[model samples]
Target chain A: MPQELFNKPVTELSGMLARGEVSAVELMRSVAERTRKVEPKVHAFNSLDEEDALAQAAASDARRAAAKASGAEVHALEGIPIGIKDVISVAGQPLTASSRMLATFVSPYDATVTTKLKAAGAICWGRLNLDEFAMGSSTENSAFGVTSNPYDLERVPGGSSGGSAASVAAGEAIASLGSDTGGSIRQPAALCNIVGLKPSYGRVSRYGLIAFASSLDQIGPFARSVDDAATVLGAISGHDRRDSTSLRMEVPDYRRGMDELRKSGRKWRLGIPKEYFGEGLDPEVGAAVQAAIAEYTKLGCEVREVSLPHTKYAVGAYYIIATAECSSNLARFDGVRYGHRSKDATDALDLYFKSRAEGFGPEVKRRIILGTYVLSSGYYDAYYLRAQKVRTLIRRDFLEAYKQVDAIVTPTSPTPAFRKGEKAANPLAMYLNDIYTIGVNLAGLPGISIPCGFTGGGLPIGLQIIGQPFKETELLAVARSYEERNDWRNRFPTL
Target chain B: MPKPEDFNLDHVANLARINLTAEEKTRFSSQLGDVLTYIAQLNEVNVDGVEPTAHAFPVVNVWADDVAEAGLPVEDALRNAPEKRDNMFVVPKVVE
Candidate 1:
């Protein structure tokens, strides 16, 4: 079978577009057709505008022609179609965040990352679904609908970036963007068998990203290959004055740096955190990650056992900190300004109460209440403050480990994608799904989930590579080393 | 450490300004109890002499030039408003 244009990575698609071998419109049509075919079963997108995508592609083609005539340099991502998770504003597009609260809301301006992608000449494609306000581990929490694992329709696409990961895995888009607050991006990418890179906190601007947990939230990319992820990361990263937390450091040429590092044949000192491979880890997933570590050992990299003692406390701290931030961030969703309003409201205060009651889903409400409680007067010191102090310990654990290792390798998720509704009833059970991935967020480190191997059941398993703060260059190179030696990136879902 | 059984669903919900249905209140009370119990494990860790990390890499004292820049036009800003009148969001009467 011929490789469809939709499945090609951004790196390859860019070369094709530059060579005039394939038109941007042709790629857009291929992606649109693929999305239309599989979207019913995958349910990865909340909304897509094919006509608008085609128009954007046409404009890209026109720019390419002009650049050719004028002997001007073309952007690296010119004409590539990338999906936007619904939480990020795309100016005039629906920014629902997969919640009923913003069911009818449209963004009035572009997110900083959106502006960056557009400037790179990429087509801002579909509005992908996510857990409402990015509060859950599975896409099932999304008010729009659950996004299914392309590998098995009965299973979930790990979330709250489930739609972003699913869309790429299903060839619905070349790549997509997702927000990672407590493993939203990496978990989904692991479940979907793709590469998801969560840059260090403040590495990517969060100016237009709908706040989930203000401190933990960082926007990242989901792509089929590590190289493509690098391409997307380069375009979207850097300082944005609009986002006060955005790092002011210079953005490196990641692809170039990755290539240079690869050529240098640098021997990486990889850490295997003992806590990550412990109880609750599926045997199959464990074997796959161990095999990946063995592969690193064979490649002449030093493998050492490192300890992140605070690992066990990550979930507890994350829920407290994230929910507390979310409770504050989501306060803007009251019916007073925009989003769904309660016609049943009688007075001003009643409006805030009823409108929120009607607009938010059960999980969102649960989180808000929990968050409010933690920040409430008496419990503040016990919960919120204690969580913050634990967070410091968590960050310190990683910093201590990095002293002995170039990067830490672990399982991206405890298990492969679970059957839909398996843990939906138990929020605590679902929270454990992100156990291995959340500590990276707490430490503000760059982490990538790449396909390591698959289970006997044919479900994909991910090997996570956690790098030092602001060290994405080394991280991508490390991930790329594993990717180059493995055939996992070549396989795709039959659906 | 606060126990899960002590979680006041009604009080918290009221503080959050969300009117949970009877069913939601019942379901969340139990569901969140499990979560709160899980969160209680944090108390086990000794945080003595540890400074709370509000942000992983806190960028302190971020200042921008105090110059007026372009703001969103009123029409565009009010575009998503559930109720709008003359380029302003119309909310339920608060003063009355």
Candidate 2:
């Protein structure tokens, strides 16, 4: 099958729309057709309404037409169709987070990210699948259906943003939005052979995103090219009063930053974190990432080895803090207000217990129990409080390294996408898949995963770039420098 | 690895408001035991005198204007309620 108009990058599509070459309705119809063709094999979307998408596309067309007649400016994403992870609310759409607890829950209002995307003229089309309540590393934990890797149907797409990555890899949408708590966006992007960025904590608003781990969760973009990701990030990022955690910083035009870095001819100091390359990393992935580093050197970027000494403790601290926050965040699904209710309940307490037990999935239940146990009277100081302190150490490690190097590079994941059910039986093994990416979240810094190369069996390898706090422009610039040197972004799965 | 026998699954389940079956309890007990064993490495870090970070950024007391805003309508608010009556979510009686 030929690549449809929907598979073009948002930049190209924007130019085409401006040049009167393609109507928004035509572009939307092509995407709808592509979704119908690829959905069965990849299972990327949770819910999609073609009628609603076309109506939105038509509205965008009318706005553009009026702008043209009045000689006014149109938004950057005037008619681009994007897939949204179900965790982010789009008003009037199902916000399930792939859990039965919100299986029938329709969002009453748009999330901050969704509102900004709509305001910038982006069409938030379908509800993408995710790990149930964004707890698991794989989408197999979703109650809806597991999203298959577009590269290989038998293997898992690295999650909990599996559907977000799979949709773009399968060319079902032009671009997509995903939330990363612990490598949710980057890991899946690497597995699917695409670009994914996790902006600095508080860089984007989180008002309408169904909270998993509040402090670490950030909504970002996934695209086939670095420019599209930058464009989308610029559109959705800014200060919002609704979320107190949102940063009070000015949003820069990130696409311009990418172009500026491409021409600056400046040598950036890149750090290779030695801890990330040792022991469990697959040999093929290490070699590919090392080669990517060499390409950076050839592009006049200085490379040196730097140590994030507390890297090992990152997973430990992340699990403790994330689960603790998740336990408190998800407590609202008690059947008193909305979501699934139990029929066997005799009293309020029974209703709470039965409704939660029936509504939550196994992984969610396990996290809730673990979180509750850690925060229990005797364990709080030893577990929850101790983890928080170690989290501070992890953040300090990154800060120390940033003084010596402009950015740190590591393999996004230890290995390529694993076969379905390979690590599902052991939760610890699944958690270790995020060993390389979780430290970025712990430090609350920006990180981007761009495809570097492929394995012998053709699975994609991702090289991650970690930046200083609120330095997404520099992060995306470094990513684009490496991106422009290779054709890796052009490769897509023939699903 | 921490001994799975040391943690009582039933007690924790009670605190979490989940009524797990015997099979689920056994499964979770062993799996969570593995995870807890892995996370036990945090004890090795020397975090003395470090202030615990609850939020990523430091923004204290972010106050908004007190003007009343148009909020979710009664119909939209109760749209997803499992049980509702008279435009309000209905729950079991808490008091006798």
Candidate 3:
């Protein structure tokens, strides 16, 4: 296996493919070899069909060869190997979402993101692990198993996009797609030491994405570099008639934004949200994030202290809203349609009970029950309605802060990756893991987490830079400035 | 915050359509109680006049033309059906 090829970013790999120095088949083979070697230790993939991946790679190579002969250019992501979160449908692949409910389910149509990746000539690798229906913070909720951090085998790769970040960090995949409802993408990227972006809600279509909380879910990219993240976002984002909520905005050339920002040498005013730095924040993680903020100052960026007054209500409001939406969305998975069916069921209602009871894992069931409680009679006004009102306040807080800052900075997670099962016993403790990151989702802003530095234990710390809605270009540029100045992104796990 | 005794686990589970065993029901009762206690902090906030935000962005009536487009073929749509009959999902008999 070629370590050099495995480590090369998509930009470099694309250049090699265009220059005819490397064939798409060769890149796929290298990745396949790497996946075979590291996957056992990391448990990053739920399932992989190597033969299919190789076949796609071969087609990409032939297409590139034909384009070169005709003096035409290939697609932007031609020959890049991309792994997709299992929740996102890729036609003909098992879309389990790391749950027994959909364990045998196969997608009939590609997700908008998957279709875009294939159109751009990227090889789609499916069945990456996630929290069952993207419910839990840690991948332990995955029915398949936990995806361990590549940096440390005992620690979790932050999830529900754990495998998405871990595979990219461990060199199993060049780039991967993960959906962020709360802090799924960014937290995992922070833990795995990679770049993860959650575009503004509706920036990307969710037609084929297994809906968790449709209002908050945004499929984004995880990569080794900010540039790669931007490239993948550009490819996947755009309006789709199939998804009525999808934004009807033009997708910007995010890759160009990086170079343009660099050439302009402009300064961005960044705000440090006061609430993020206090209470339950690990000292070492705080130090690393603060150091990254200081580096921004050195890079000619100004930092100001800003307060999101309603920050405390974010976690409660998020759970209320997310789970309520999830209860409705996941109801479609009853045994009759496409997911798991109960063999012992005697009637239609018995089938739903037995199937959902046996199919969904504990965390998912907990959420469904809680969501049901919140939306149930008599409780809806006190719980769900109040949470919605609080949600508005949280969103208003962000709107107020954006007036003073171009991007807001914080730690993507309260602490670095914790040992697997550490927070399993107490659901609230696990929910608190996303305290800093959840506020961004509730506000529906675009947020990116870039590897800032490492804790004393060698775990990665992620510095979150949040931007106003649809300002991912500025957000990425701010992240790029930090990523370029620091050598943190260059480090890879010993695995 | 409501005490653990305040919740009826069986009712909630029934509403969620999950049939939990005796042990799971007891465990979930406590766990759900703890989570609810934590979430009860939302009551501390003053949300008197704030409008609820259902969607992060405002969206309404995004209608496509009243014309049908090609949809998933019957075979493809039913490909993942766990049980089927006559090109339709086979569910347990509903009417007595």
Tens digit of per-residue lDDT, candidate 1, span A1-495: 257899888888999999999999999999999999999999999999999999999999999999999999998789999999999999989999899999999999999999999999999999999999998988999999899999999999999999999999999999999999999999999999999999999999999999989999999999989999999999999999999999899999999999999899899999999999899999999999999999999999999999999999999999999999999999998897789999999888999999999999988988889999999998999999999999999999999998899999999999999999999899999998989999999889999999998999999999999999999999999999989998887789988
User: Lowest summed-lDDT stretch of 10 residues in model 3 chain B?
Assistant: B1-10
* Model 3 stretches with alpha carbons more than 4 Å out: A1-3, B1-5
* Backbone Cα, N, C clashes tallied per candidate: 0, 0, 0
DockQ score for model 2:
0.70
Candidate 1, residue A473: lDDT: 96
DockQ of each: 0.89, 0.70, 0.79
Q: Which residue pairs in candidate 1 collide?
A: none
- Model 3 lDDT per residue over A168-258, tens place: 9999899999999999999999999999999998899998999999889999999989989999999999999989999899999987977
Q: List the residue pairs that clash in candidate 2.
A: none
Candidate 1: where are CA atoms >4 Å away? none
Best by TM-score: 1
TM-score of each: 0.99, 0.98, 0.98
Give a tens-digit lDDT track for model 2, residues A344-446. 9999999999999999999899888888888877788888888888888888888999998989999999999999999888888999999998988878899
Comparing to the true complex, what docking class would candidate 1 get? high
Tell me, by lDDT, which candidate is best: 1
- Residue A250 displacement (Å), model 1: 0.3
Task: Tell me the lDDT of model 3 at A373.
Answer: 84
Interface RMSD of each: 0.8, 1.9, 1.2
lDDT of 2 by residue, B1-96 (tens): 233356778988898899999899889888998888888777778878999977767789899999999988888888888988887778888999
